[model samples]
Target: MSIPVNTTAQIWVPARRAADVTARGARLLRMADGCAVFAVGSGTHHFLTRGRPRG
Candidate 1:
């Protein structure tokens, strides 16, 4: 899946394929330890964080 470049917020990509961010409406971010995590939901409605395997 591809995200449009016109998106307002920043888009993140996972280092591994443990979770399908596109299927869950989520995005991946890099941590200080170089690990990857998925961020789901927007604003304060609902949010989740999950660890992903390293690439």
Candidate 2:
């Protein structure tokens, strides 16, 4: 499965701040046309739908 580019979707990404203790968590990210991706450690992950589609 693949996430379409330019689509707004929820994804889990590496915490951007040192204060964030969870290491990784869910976030709403706008999928980019060319650079949209999800990764952890040294591996890449795919994005899956949580519920219904968003507009």
Candidate 3:
């Protein structure tokens, strides 16, 4: 699936800093190699809701 442009509000931080960011409540989305992605702010909700398939 592709992330919506408008709702994409995330930050890429080094794996070491992932814990620090998460400690502040950012949701961890992905981690690969030594990089990490954390979703922040209200855009996360918008992104999730917009991508859901309606019945």
RMSD per candidate (Å) reads 8.3, 11.2, 13.5
Off by over 4 Å in 3: 1-8, 16-22, 42-55
Ranking by lDDT: 3, 1, 2
Global CA lDDT computed for model 3: 0.49
Clashing pairs in 1: none
| Top-lDDT candidate index | 3
Between candidates 1 and 2, name the one with more favorable lDDT. 1
Worst 10 residues of 1 by lDDT: 40-49
Go through the candidates in order and give each one's C-alpha lDDT: 0.42, 0.34, 0.49
Number of clashes in every candidate structure?
Answer: 0, 0, 0
Candidate 3 on 1-55: residue-level lDDT in tens?
Answer: 2345556566665554344333244678886555567676542232121222222
What's the best-to-worst order under TM-score? 3, 1, 2
Model 2, global lDDT:
0.34
| Structure candidate 3, residue pairs in collision | none
Candidate with the larger TM-score of 1 and 3: 3
Candidate 2 accuracy as TM-score: 0.20
True-vs-predicted CA distance for residue 15, candidate 3, Å: 1.4
C-alpha lDDT (0 to 100) for residue 12 of candidate 1: 43
